[model samples]
Target chain A: MDSDIRLLSDLAPGQQAVISAVHADEALHQRLVALGFRIGRNVLLMRRGRWAGPLQVRLGATDVMLRRAEAGLITVRAA
Target chain B: MKRIALLGMPNTGKSTLFNRLTGSSARVANWAGVTVDLASAKILLGGHMAEMVDLPGIYDLHGFSDDEKVVRHFLEAHAIDVLAVVVNATQIERQLPLVLQARSLGLPLVLLLNMADAAKRHGMQVDTARLAARLGLPVVMISAKYGTGQAEALRVLAHSLDAALEIGPARHAALKSVLSDDVRIERETAEMMAEAVTQPLLLPEQVSDRIDRLALHPWLGLPLFFVAMLVMFQAVFWLGAPLQQGLTGLFDQLRQSALEPLAAVLPDFVRGLLLDGVYAGFVTVAAFVPLIVLFFLFMALVEDSGYLARAAFLTDALMGKLGLDGRSFVMVLMGFGCNVPAVMGTRMMRERPLRLLSMLVIPLSLCSARLQVFLFIVSAIFRPAQAPWVIFGFYVASFATMILTALLFRGRFRNTEPFVVELPPWRVPTLRQVWMRGWLEVRHFLSRATRFIVLGVIAIWLLTNLPAGATPGSVATLAGQLGTLFAPILAPIGIDEKLTVALLFGFVAKEVMIGAFAVIYGLSGDALAHEFARNMNWVQAVSFMLFTLIYTPCMSTIATIKIESRSAAFAALSVLWPLALAWFTSFVFYQGMRLFIGG
Candidate 1:
């Protein structure tokens, strides 16, 4: 399976996965790296909200909301 | 002191996060790109001061769209302390691309995994520490709703600010190894999001789906939609009454106490300018203020509650049938308040042809200014009960003109892009946001209308006062000469020479249409409405109003179209096409109705 870090939202709550792909351009790639998304991160989904928008997850000691459309591009696997 | 930039895709809780952090509800929703400009505020985090810049939501830094360029420019110019890349935890795969892109900017980054509680309920889990180590940055899980994990996110954010962390250029090579060649680092941000989000669970409470089943259905939906539109139209006039009366009375009193006293001290020319031009202009404009308020209040309610999007979806298929994009519906609804903003709102349509096409058709959308004209004439000529239906007829005429005109245009230049819009999640609207938005709309109307009305009234006063001692209908009088020129065109519509001129002036500013009619008819035996009724029968009065409603939009609206569409020819076409249709429709209605009713 594709392990794009952006696709962490595809996993069910408590399901863990590793990012397989980053799926974007040079500038975008640099920006994402500066934001902490990189190859080989173990991403976990913590919860989902209305319309699959504003999803929460544990990335380090922080949580974030992910738009569903954005979440669809990432390829991941069950851990 | 430190800085935090709240960045995310449209409707990804960035605003909610801002609200949570700043205690200001700056319009958070499930929809995307609602914030057009960056809004910033101060906050204290982890014993350090900070300024939070809430940038507009965008998918990527492609900078193709105007909004995208704005975000990119802001990021490029500002020397930020830390980039707080907020992402929806439920959809991390897609959200991560933006995160990764932001991280690659070589800033100290702290990824906020917001909406964690909802993700957990849906059976998704994320490991923060491991992901942070992998990404080589700090990450925190947060539920902007439940207020969980905010402190941790703030602490991590503060730490990143102090560290001045920077990602090396080799990160792109690392990203390429993870995804395909086509999958750039921008796409990498959301890789984890794609893996994390599950499909939404089905529920019985899908009101939009239920509404769409009927509202988007081919045969029944059109007629039902028409009926619903009629009800809303009727409701505007019917429900807007008490408030109208109260406001009018207040203005009337203000005119007596304040303006009348000021008029006394001024010289004759100045008094006329102050009293007739300024004060009277205010009264003319103020009468419609309540109507604007009520219309916008309802519109705000519709907007905040997410029904406006559903309406767009319901009408998309029909609009497509008419060769208009679903986005055009938004511009049209805005037309009900004013056409200027309707023209500006056309920017939301990305497709060029559709944007131009919508701009061409929007001025014909029967704005609230024209509604005042309709109400003025209808109340004077027809019975109260019959008035609603008469106004309803004009509303129907505007829509028909739009449909027919679009059909004609499409036959010449057709566009076939499916309106693939994502309906935002429904939210329980907060009254604070609704009222603030509503008040802003109300303020816009008041300021825009009053200024134009004052100038228009002064010009009308100058024209009437000119060719001294000349009565209306005389060749020497400027107003009379203009009325005479427009007379032949309006004769078939059964409007008098004076009213013909008034209607022509109406194109300059709709409020002036009323004030000119007032000056012309008020000079004679009665009010403009009564003079209209006395000169022409009820059928003709109704026809005259219908003509005004469907005619060219006011001067400001035309100018706005020029700016928005960036083509003078398109704006000119918008004017002439509608004027021709307005004439033809009025002629048919007046002639056909008179024969049937035996006028």
Candidate 2:
């Protein structure tokens, strides 16, 4: 179970994960936290951009498109 | 008058509700960022007048985003009798934090459950009275789009403000201390939703998921995006072009039937100024109104359908590499239709540097007006078979110019802003809503930009017509003299004296270029083509079109950039930057041609 941890950017399309941690610069993390990407929250990767673009993820009823580069800041455990 | 302000996260029909209350056509669409600035109007509430302010949407009142700052500043400057927080009934869980944050401000508050009809269709229900009792604030459910329960909502808002007016502001509670932490606020929202809302396990999100499966397919998505853009702009052009032509014809007929008879009563100078200088020049720019409205209307549909945000998601990586975001890409595509509205469209972007940089590159989009110039010149010079290729070459050149401009100035206008966007669910906008959206933007453009463009036209008219008795646009007038003065410099770029005069006319509007040539060479149609051939060869024609592709945008664009950026220096830079690029580009093309082919 501990080995299942991975960056959100690594989750393939249709994979669901629980956010483990979000580490980024202050502003980026603030935005992430504001959008409900916190520890223990479930995130479903509905789809992602081609060539490592933004990732389209759903948090509860909200869908957010976060850049892949920024998605790297979010670590999640595959569920 | 007492003031009631609307606040909520984006796309909650706050502006639509404001329109219902005030009967003012403020800009409203499904996108998250249309209301970059606030719009307000006054209405009678209870027995007195009260101002209704529609603010740019904000996720959190305490958040430090640009829209939030605008909201905070409004609160600081004006005393709000009632802060009506409008939230989508379907999005109560995520939207509740904003209402709680506003509650800490201690203002008399009314929670509006807007879009109740859509929420019911999607199987979400809000218990308004229970929520009111739990939070100690009035909660009303209303459909802003369809005006359902508007009267009830109005009555509640009036009652809340009536209570507020009886008792003045309650020391405007200390803003900093009572604010709840993010975790606590989120927990409170969850508890409130549990008590007062019934959200079905499954709603219409499945429909969006089904659509996005194909729309966001890795392989099919990019091609779909390109095709959608082509169809959209083509639709705008083909549909709006006839309307533009009709307006042009109507103006010409009006001049012929209405003004020509007055020719005998007024002096020739007054008549020329009124007819040729003012009427002709302004009408040429005015003919673009149809295209501008169509652009806003179609863009509203794309936004209302929720694909615009997905488009951003799809293109962010590529556009990011070029130092722009996917939002900039849409505006640039819009530039193919017209540059003025495209430049205006940059207001959707929040960051100043990114918006300004997008403005710098948008004018290079080879708008349809420039396409008109290229079409005539390409047909006049190149073969029928080679014509399409030559025109296509300009499209490539236009993109090359945009990329280079982006890359070159990306560092100068660099911003380290994050690119996080919320994707709203898809919904079809009503035809009346779409029509109102288009008309409001058109009215905004006409009211603000018309004065400056008319002034610029008059300035050009004076330059070409001064020194009475001198022929219009001839060697003796100021325009001709200036053209002659610039001819030697433009010579390295393959432009001559008469062509230079037309270039000057083009600054007023690109569509004026053909008429400028007819005026200068005293020819048109086939005769004009023969004269054009005698003036220069195919190479010169290519070089000239290249110059026009990147040169200074028309007067209206400059005025819009001035209005949008609010900086005269920035507007001056927009002009000088392109002028320099055009000169350098054409100079290299012409000189390089002579060196290689000795043509």
Q: How many residue pairs clash in each candidate?
A: 132, 0
RMSD of 1: 16.6
Q: How many Å off is the CA of A45 in candidate 2?
A: 1.0
Lowest lDDT block of 10, candidate 2 chain B = B27-36
Report the C-alpha lDDT of model 2 over B262-315, residue by residue, as the tens digit: 685998877766666667656655666676677678866776677777777777
TM-score of 1: 0.59
Off by over 4 Å in 2: B1-203, B331-359, B366-396, B411-416, B498-502, B505-545, B553-575, B588-599
Estimate, for each residue in B165-213, the C-alpha lDDT of model 1 and write its tens digit.
3544364344334333323433554675588864333223466446545
Model 1: runs farther than 4 Å from truth?
A1-79, B1-231, B246-277, B472-476, B523-528
Chain B, candidate 2: TM-score: 0.56
Estimate every model's Cα lDDT from 0 to 1: 0.67, 0.76
